[model samples]
Target: MTAQTTPKPTESELEILQILWDKGSCTVREVHEVLEKNKDSGYTTTLKLMQIMHEKGLVARDTSSKTHIYRALVNQEKTQQHLVNKMIDNVFNGSAARLVMQALGNHTASKEEIDSIKKYLDELSNQ
Candidate 1:
């Protein structure tokens, strides 16, 4: 699906998507192992989630092998942009500047990240 048409993933689905996005492709067990490190969940639960994600068009499944491999179908950047835009609108009252200010105030950004933000701001001003 197009970025604009990508379905909003549930929190559970988003977690699975993140794993797929990071690892490129993985079997359910591989994903579950990573997930288990953070939270308590069953292998069957991960399998079911991946199946649901496949049906939702959020991920692609390769059934060529006995061990099915799944990969994220949605673009990572697009998903992040979508979620961030929604948060900015709903939580920050559509004020991107306020969102930026709040985030910077609450979080400790690395020097490199601060420099990157400044560079992005400079580019935006140039445009």
Candidate 2:
């Protein structure tokens, strides 16, 4: 058993991942139905995408039954952290503060969200 490096999912792959994460394990057909509502794509395309994701170790496939069920193997938090780290390095020059500032400045965070962020910051300061 080897540790798998997280690969940045393509736009299509991310869509499928979002489905798997939200819906849990699903057959490719089940995924395709949800996908069709958002964008035009063939069932074969969805199947192929899941196949590639399996190969990349981003998703796990249960092949016991006639209809294979696919589930996300990559943790959503880990992937978000990985992407955030990449963005911080590339877009903000490794400054998480800059990213936070930009995010807060661009979006009007609710009072609850601001308070939550402040609480987190206070805890970090204590640490």
Candidate 3:
């Protein structure tokens, strides 16, 4: 079969993906438990979401034993980059500089964060 490329996940699906990214492979119950810590969600709701994610090619399931284990199919960095690009285009009119400016201006960055950003810029300048 040809490899399938899943579309960008929905907000709730992203939430589940975050958990899978952080925790690695998980069962439906395992995913449900972690989400429960943050939001009051039903286990079945989480299960259904994950099932749909499987159909969407966003997650892979292993049915080796009894409980099927699910893992995120997309790389976290790639997905984040894709989403950021979409946001920059849609919200900032394709200007990454504007996106950076809005982020820096609206959010308080620590001295360390500012220093890190400056260092990154310096490295980019040398190249």
Candidate 4:
């Protein structure tokens, strides 16, 4: 099986991947420090999670140093696209319109945001 066939990231892994994506490359201690700023995370927890992620091929480790820098193997945009496609297919019955309608109905949007969305739709329709 190829990387594409790999299972989707677990929730914990996703959190770690997000940090890697944003920070570019980090040591487990650095990641844990950043995560601690946001939530109650521990160093060992981050280190263990990064090791698991490396085994799963979700992250790459630079072993040039004893510090072992970690980086995300997947592109953020590609991951987001795959996740959105899965969500649209499974939760919206493969209908993009239904997905948008459900999301718009469930959340409150500012008038400016609505106008921007309408403009985007118009552009897509024109194309």
Candidate 5:
């Protein structure tokens, strides 16, 4: 197997990360409550997941206090950019134009959105 340059969390792990990122820090119960909005997740499941995440270095657990608060160690924006770049490299074969063309063809973007994208492209070209 290739060396893992990026940490790829499972969907469940990503869900937990999203909660910690949004709430700053939360106990397993708190995270489970927030996660319950979407699906039926167990309290223990959340606790176990967070524990595993801490071991993986994806999250930091504060055990000094009464309540074990979990916080994300990785910045969400940086992780998102890394994932996007990896996807672009693998799926789009490093052709941004291919991705853009596919996106434009797949979705019905508003005229304003199209204009905004065009404006950005124009600015980049100018630079």
Candidate 6:
């Protein structure tokens, strides 16, 4: 699906998408294992969520094998942009500068990360 047509994933779905995006493709059991480490989630729940994600066109399933393998259908960068843009509009009064200031104020950035952000800002200024 085109980026515009891609459905927004829920918080739970975003968790699943993160795993799928990292691993490329994985079975329900594999995803559940990783999720269980971070939260108390059942395998069946992960399976159901993935099934729903498939229906939502966020993921594609490979059912040829006995165990189904799922992969993210939506692009990760596009999803991040969509979510960030929504947050900028809804939470920051459409000011991305406000969002950036809030994020930097609340969280401590590593030296490398700060340098990266500075580099990005330089590039933006140059453009």
Provide the clashing-pair count of each candidate structure: 0, 0, 0, 0, 0, 0
Error of 6 at 76 (Å): 0.2
Q: Write the per-residue lDDT of candidate 6 for residues 1-127, one digit (tens) a residue.
A: 6766779999999999999999999999999999999999888999999999999999999999999999999899989999999999999999999999999999999999999999999999999
Residue 98, candidate 2: Cα error in Å is 1.4
Candidate number that wins on lDDT, 2 or 4: 2
RMSD of each: 1.2, 1.9, 2.1, 2.2, 3.3, 0.9
How many backbone clashes are present in model 2?
Answer: 0
lDDT values of the candidates? Answer: 0.94, 0.91, 0.92, 0.88, 0.87, 0.95
Query: Which has the higher lDDT value, candidate number 4 or candidate number 5?
Result: 4
Winning model by lDDT? 6
What TM-score should be assigned to candidate 6?
A: 0.97
Instruction: Return the TM-score for candidate 5, rounded to 2 decimals.
Output: 0.79
| Residue 40 of model 5, lDDT score | 94
- TM-score attained by model 2: 0.87
Ranking by lDDT: 6, 1, 3, 2, 4, 5
Where's the lowest-lDDT run of ten residues in candidate 5? Answer: 1-10
| Candidate 4, superposed: residue stretches over 4 Å from native | 1-3, 110-112
Error of 4 at 74 (Å): 0.7
Which pairs of residues have clashing backbones in candidate 2? Answer: none
Summarize candidate 4's per-residue lDDT along 25-73 as a digit string, tens digits: 9999988988888789778988998999898889999999889999999
Residue pairs in steric clash, candidate 3? none
Q: Give the clashing residue pairs of candidate 4, or none.
A: none
- Residue-wise C-alpha lDDT for candidate 1, range 1-127, written one tens digit per residue: 6766677899999999999999999999999999999999999999999999899899999999999999999999988999999999999999999999999999999999999999999999999
Write the number of the candidate with greater lDDT, choosing between 4 and 6: 6
